[model samples]
Target: MDTTPPPSRPATLTAPRLVERLIQGQATSDGAGVRLTRLLTQDLQRRLDPFLMLDLFGTENPGDYIGGFPDHPHRGFETITYMLQGRMRHRDSAGNEGLLVPGSVQWMTAGRGVIHSEMPEQQEGAMEGFQLWLNLPGRDKMREPWYRDIATAEVPEWQGEGVTARVIAGATHGVQGAVQRDATEPLYLDLHLAPGAVFTQPLPAHHNAFVVVYRGELNVAETLVRTRRMAILANTPGSDGVLLRAGEAGARAILVAGQPLKEPIAQYGPFVMNTQQEIFDAVNDFRAGRLA
Candidate 1:
């Protein structure tokens, strides 16, 4: 069956996007005491400009996630949480509250600042998800904070040719995700591929793209990337996209991309700004009760 969606024809390039670097996500704890895998962070490599941190948290043990993320404050960036298995109850200082179940996404923009808490709704089972941090441009760093919650039904899915991908943002084939923001022009998708399946996606030439493999193995470019690893795509001037193929065991992964800000990044704790003084100001603001 030729069920795969017909790929859009893009301008031919001299080469294909190649793997630039490979990062292995390591286990860590954040929030109140929730254990997770920190995939990318400013401390690890600041070169990934507009994009900040990525954490994969999943476990069957209640104690691992029950502590949850206690009341915490953030500023100067956005936080995205996507659930694959369990439920999370979230409440923010902005009077925003919601329950995120499987296949749900919550995008929180802690522009000036925000205090929020995320706790598990169920005692135990399989709790799993990813939390990503995207940096705000210098101009929008101090804007008002807000949130957008996209339920499973709201996210568009592209299924064909032994592949199913939930488009969380950006366009794939002809489907677009519900979370649309012009600032970053991001693409976030959850993908599942059957054995021997191949999938390819076109991205803007200048955009930064990466794949995080959480299950099975993937042949990215020509390199074998296994579980708990992230493959960074090279920004080849001539290349227009990336390619992937599932290994024998099949594969599950997340693809995320965004236009790079290409600006000075001053980051400290939960704040990210352009300059060190700006970071200091953010800290003072949080302590002075101005960040909310």
Candidate 2:
């Protein structure tokens, strides 16, 4: 893969969105005691429509992530796993298998349903990454299951003055991302910024957006967002985009935005549907061994 940064094409923004709220992730453990932080919890589901959850896990200790995620079932949603460091093997009931390595991404859509597992390929060393749950529209909830593994070299990157952005799911500058979905029109970007550098991204007025800082600190519309914190961008009318400036020490963050489905969201553990009846059906299907 070419390691050179692409040509810069700065984005223009007349009005930048402000941070509506700063969220501190709750320390949590899931998948057989693998430690993680739940940044976008259930309470904020409605506010960030089309986005269900965001979990950040990073640790150098083997005990923190050794067990890994065992067999699990999911329905009516999509999972995007971006690996920053380490290796994880994914296997699904659909017969799809992939290995996620550093800077790789696995996008799996459990449209109707699917059973899967993600286990660490390493017993020691640093493991870091994120798993984002994107809700499927009710109309397409039961379409079909889909999966894809995007290697690190396949993810497109855009370079700016002092920033490098990895476009994972939408267009950034003139570079298109590795994956694109028509319904939600999601935009996912992992940005690395040099000290005191600014990165601007123009966004649709009606789309919902947020940023999660992982390294150092960032300023969004003058609101300081520290490491491990998530900043929800306000949906102020007439706002064109967001402007992110890195703190003196530099910063790395992921910015995600998507068009809201504006549909009723009914969730039950691993199954997300449009109504209680659908949830019950999902449960029944899983119990009867029909959810593959």
- Using lDDT, give the best candidate's number: 2
Please write out the lDDT profile of model 2 over residues 1-292, one tens digit for every residue.
Answer: 9998566856889999999999999999999899999999999999999899999999999999999999999999999999999999999887889999999999999999999999999989999999999999998999889988999999999889889999999898888999999999999999999999999999998999999999999999899999999999999999999999999999999999999999999999999999999999999999999986
Give the number of the best model, judged by TM-score.
2
Give the local distance difference test score of model 2: 0.95
Q: What lDDT score goes with residue 287 in model 2?
A: 93
Task: Give TM-scores for every candidate, taking all chains together and pairing residue i with residue i.
Answer: 0.93, 0.97
Worst 10 residues of 1 by lDDT: 7-16
lDDT of each: 0.87, 0.95
TM-score, structure 2 vs. true: 0.97
lDDT of 1 by residue, 145-233 (tens): 98999988888988767888899988787888877778889899899998978878887778888899989999987989999899998
